[model samples]
Target chain A: MSTTLTPKSSPIDSPDLRAWKSASGGGDTSQPPGLLSGAFLQETLAMTRRLFIQLQRRPSTLVAGVIQPLIWLFLFGALFQNVPQGLFGESSNYGQFLAAGIIVFTAFGGALNAGLPVMFDREFGFLNRFLVAPLASRYSIVVASAIFIAALSIVQTAAVITLSAFLGAGWPDPLGLALVVLILLTLVLGVTALSLGLTFALPGHIELIAVIFVTNLPLLFASTALVPLDFMPGWLQVVASLNPLTYAIEPIRYLYLHPDWSLGSVVLQSPWGSISLGVCLAVLIGFCAIALLAIQPLLRRRIA
Target chain B: MPPAVLIEKLKKSYGSVEAVKDVSLTIQPGEIFGLLGPNGAGKTTTIRCLCTLASPDSGNIEINGTSVVDDPKVARQSLGYIAQEVALDPVLTGRELLQLQADIYHIPRKVSRDRIPQMIDLLELTDWADKKTGTYSGGLKKRLDLALGLLHQPEVLVLDEPTVGLDIETRSAVWQFLRQLKAAGTTVLITSHYLEEVDALADRVAIIDNGVVIAAGTPNELKDRIGGDRITLRIREFTPDDEARSAQEMLARLPFVQEVIINSAQGNSLNLVVEPQSDALLSVQQSLKEAGLSTFGISQSRPSLDDVYLAATGRTLMDAELAAVGTRNLKKERKEAMKGT
Candidate 1:
């Protein structure tokens, strides 16, 4: 490939290369890096830092994530403040029952919207920057999103819990609170996986937003978040019982009412049968596994 | 020892549109290779395949002897791609963005601690390094992008239109930086539609038209191979259609004149190919005087890369570029979607 050049067309004079050569690693490897390799963690942390920097510059997403559910808590709590005695069949006020529902739904809502940043990255050509890099795994992209969304969910969950506690909804014991956090995290993981999947499945942000809008409200109303299954008619009761949020909500509500809660204790009387706390945990884990597995082929096809 | 970059018989299509019909290139180490083509001539598609942004229907691409198709991770480690449009996250400061790039490339913290400063100084971005990229000017953004591309010091650096829309100073800075890269033993590949850009920097170039290479050689070799000294003469400034046609006929009849084309886009000036090192210009002027034609102006020089393009494709690069602009990026978007990650 070499061609001779006359002196008149000789190469130009240049600066020294010590700096560039000094910093050069260029660690070229034939094998793809493993999922949890140091390279993977490095890239994932870098990406997560970028997202956080953006959030720091523009704190509206985090602010809204914390505040939007509080608005729901206040508005709905006051609207249902007049529910007669024995209607809920639990603690005194609607706020007490609503707190668990709000915490779970808050985490779920935030997780569902995790794909927007990725979708924006796609449309704006920023994602192509990562796509062309020598990433260990494209799942680093998914994992980064998971980390950012998970952090936001924690902040939002804490906000909801604190606000609900102040609104006459008593706090669960330390163990009960830990269980509540575990449930919310599991639910967040499954929903976030689905959201990232949709980031690749759909064409652009507009369509993803449409799907989010179509999804956000119906899930909340269908689950036991706003009302118990028995409060609904027969058909609505069936839909509410089948909802995943119902599984999450009933377990947390049981923790609040039963001081000595156990995994074997029946937390929910679903239309199917008596669902124990352990069974609910198993279902959430299964959902999360299926979601993570289902998006693998899609992510591989998209970026791997 | 192997070629720095190799692409053989690459073919890719988007549905019925064949973006790359067949392209083969072998770039030696420590040389600057330029891919010159008008927009939509498959320059970017060929680049996309090389950079692992898109898979070709059939081809082989190797970077520093690693097959990009079979083992892209290693190939990616050896290739650095600087895209045409700046893709920085505006919210992040330039230093932060550079740091992010280094991390993603897995540059160790100890090296990057010094590496990032060297890059900032190289691009003369030290003052602007700590400012948010959203506040950067177009030239600053492009400079930062160049720094990011060079941070890891890949074996080959590929830039897609490194300076299509830049001020003269920035363009010169970029050209100088590329020269410095070559001096440091890095193979450089740039895709550009600018004739002078290719001529000025490329050690060798492939001129593509409509998804295939029509000509490939050193710029001087291509001009010499076409075998003519070009002359541009106008019968009159803003010559009328009839006058330009008559002048073209008169010039073509000359013993030294090989070809003549009326350039209506340039005030109907007549472009001519004449015998090299001959008194073709003087003879043509004498003939025009006998024909009672007024010579507005006339000049002669060695054929430029644009002339080479005109000879190969039967159209000027500007004309092809203008036509491409009319089609808009709608088709480009469709092609990008067909890449189908």
Candidate 2:
């Protein structure tokens, strides 16, 4: 808590002078300061603040992130607008049914790109700046990125929810809206973890970008994001149900359509078995835990 | 008292290429030590080990009495490293970047608020403090990096090629700043391929070649050990080989002249190393004039650090750098650098 502004003196004028006289000389040289909880928290918050400031100054990424999904919502809904009533099931129109899928997909897509900046940091050698510092914990790098991505996901989710209501897909009940937020948070956390892991493991940003390009769209189509599992062939249904995005989408969809639902209510009927709402939540949590655990070795090698 | 930095028998190999075979050095407190080598001669590798950024295969690196291998976190706190390449987040202002650096070192908020501006003033960065680093010129960025490295008041500051590519004015400014840091009782370690840079800055120097320390001493000590005055003589601007050989033979007979060789690369000029205090230049000119050969140009000087390098390695630093460029695996080297602690 002691703060002193020692006047800057040229070393030539006072050859024997020691800068930081109190901290650098004499007492208590045995201990390092970065290990304390307060110190670690201060570092993590500062790093996270830098990311937010960047986002604020460069608003294009956020604007494009929100706008791209809305564009998809309008285009995709109009494409299926003429389909026979009730054919897509339960909703008044295609736009109503399609809004849930687009919300989940948009959040999932944005989270998948979280590693691009980290990968760029690695290539540009900015990561070395962090490595040399006496940081309390290297996990702060991961924590900072997670916080940035989560905030972006929330803003995008709100945009889609508001737009969906305008497009005649009535608002979900308060409890249902809360469930949507929980589902988005869990999915974003897991995906962000995986993306950050790839950033460290891949040799360069080009390779990481290639992997993102290959993985993004295929995972979306294979899941129940755009179409229900029942609409696909039997084998395709099995694949769709196995995809993690489906687990996230189906619960939110069930929440929007069935406000009186309980945890015991079956949310998804997969080829393997019927999954209740509780089991879906458990699956998403487990997916996140596994993703976090999977990146441990990679992070250790780069951060330790 | 413990040395400010100690590195012994350090070795690091990338795949089949042995980058650093064996290197050992000790830097005294408050002294400026220079690690001199060609581009790929392991200077960077040795510094990397000392900073705890890379682990050596088999060696000891201690900073301020703390073993970097055994307790890197403590050693890291004692040292501030400025990498050769300046890496800055384009979006952050110079001041914001320093704040991030303060956080990483765990400098208390109160201390950071007071110390940050002092560092900015010390480095003469006030005019550019509020501008985003992306718009900064190369010299400005390097200065900002120095400020960040010194913000914690580290006991030892390590810089890898501090002025590799800078305008003359900026380079001199950096040199002046480093000397000030040393005067304040901060030990400084610098690595450079430029012979004059090391000559001008280091209190002691270790000359490395092919991943090994071939010679180590103060500049004067090394020059004195090689003990001789050198004279370069050219009969004509581009002398014939026979004439150069005859001149070499004639100069070899003089009692004060120790050795002579025809340097074919420089127009077949004759290079001579003579005993100190010997009027070797006048004798060579007189001998050449008697032989009906006109003196094109002649010069005499004491042995330099380059002469010491030439004596130990049998190759000039420029030649070594050219050879290294041909053999270097740039991609592999970058990947190796990226491999963390």
Candidate 3:
């Protein structure tokens, strides 16, 4: 009896109120047509736009993504500045041999951190907004993150290529440059897909960040990113040869050394055998395909 | 023409914990329906299943006669959900967030262009519409959430604890807006543990406890089914133990009084359940006076929803809420909620 009744009167009576009533009435509340095609595109674009807006407002990530590699190119390149010219494999300067490794590693690092944003979204419950909405496909959420990371990788690749050029690592011919971009794109797409898979599979941001921390530096050290495979002991050589990053690095390095290199040009001399530039590209494609396919079950289970 | 929302025998469990054992509800068009329960009583789990955010282990759910499991996309198009927690992009401006919502819901550009401003004005968000949502207060964020939920104007608008943390003024504003929405023929399904909130807004309510629907009906119907009026009499503010016991014994023997309890929590107040009558208040006062006990306060009123909850659950809603708080594993629940299926 002490409870006051809910008020029955409107606090704001305006013509705009009628608009809300009519808007609900104006459209049929049925599923949209072409849900798989048009609606998927719309939802993915909207989600991607949100990430870009965040990047635009907070450019620190982009600045760091570019700047971090430049520092590596400078300091690490300087550490080996006195190494004999041909010791890095037929390159007159260590900077030239180091450029391909740095470019591919930078892209790999950028793509590897792709899961952090999605994990943060999960932690903050912002991802719930996407889950509850009638998204055409939940994979649009994954697709958006992939798109954003790919764009960032491209920008970082361009910046690394330019900085290396200034350090006396001459730019490749137009075709070789195009091949370098292709190699970076393939590597980034694979790693980004794998990162996103971890986002959905992990419990929270802390777990995801922990995984990234353990995976990031070890993969760099184990691959041919910092040193040529021949510099490693026999056991380490096997691990390096098996690493997909090695496949990505060797092809780009070959393109840097041979401006007119063909797909059949030999890029890596492995314990297994000689690996050609074309085989390296093919290996990267296979890695991407397998990474993408491996996450299908996780995505279906998580996002449905 | 079909029921705006229908959920039948819905059951969902997370690992060993059964969040929703068996729950069912039917909501009509143009009326506000409430799912009342304590925390961890599976209210959110029920809402999530209906929204297609989580799949039920076994059940049938429909939105406007569309089978949710069979065609969730169509069902989702007919439903708009306002979650218990406000999940806004802190970095995005209010307008930008609304734009993102509109795009995801597939509201056409031409339609949303006018609709967005209309919502901004209707929700009284015109001033803060361009600012980052992180800068807004709790009330402002809730208002923007409401606007986002209402932007597409689905036939069924589901709100989960819409006023849980709102101020008095904001709460009343939301109540008023819901009334207008009902007047304009939108079906609303809401959940809350607040007895008065459900009492005030719900046309029909289902009281859930321990993952089951223990009672369901109009608020008045459930209260009337209890078939009694509650009277609280404070004999002397701090009545002596003997005097309070005597009053309880005397009140228990009265033909009109069906039950009596000494509420030690309220300074030994005697609470009575009596048959509804015109002079129940006066009769109780006279009975107390004849026994030589001074009446500090006395009042009689119709049975409230709390009484109905107590009648079914054998515990007051507050006590049940406290119990739930002690037992709930909020961290695990959040993790389960994030899973899609």
Complex DockQ per candidate:
0.36, 0.33, 0.40
Candidate order by lDDT, decreasing, is: 3, 1, 2
Ranking by DockQ: 3, 1, 2
The predicted structure with the larger lDDT, 1 or 3, is 3
- For model 2, give the RMSD to the true fold: 4.3
Instruction: Check candidate 3 and list the clashing pairs.
Output: none
Model 1 regions more than 4 Å off: A1-14, A22-24, A27-31, A233-238, A302-304, B235-243, B286-296, B328-339
**What Cα-based lDDT does every candidate model obtain?**
0.84, 0.83, 0.85
Error of 2 at B242 (Å): 6.0
In terms of docking quality, how is candidate 2 classified?
acceptable
Clashing residue pairs found in predicted model 2:
none
Chain A TM-score, prediction 2: 0.89
**What is the TM-score (0 to 1) of candidate 3?**
0.94
Worst 10 residues of 1 chain A by lDDT: A1-10
Query: What lDDT score is found at residue B222 in candidate 2?
Result: 94
Q: Could you give the DockQ of candidate 3?
A: 0.40
Off by over 4 Å in 3: A1-18, A24-36, A302-304
Q: Which candidate number maximizes DockQ?
A: 3
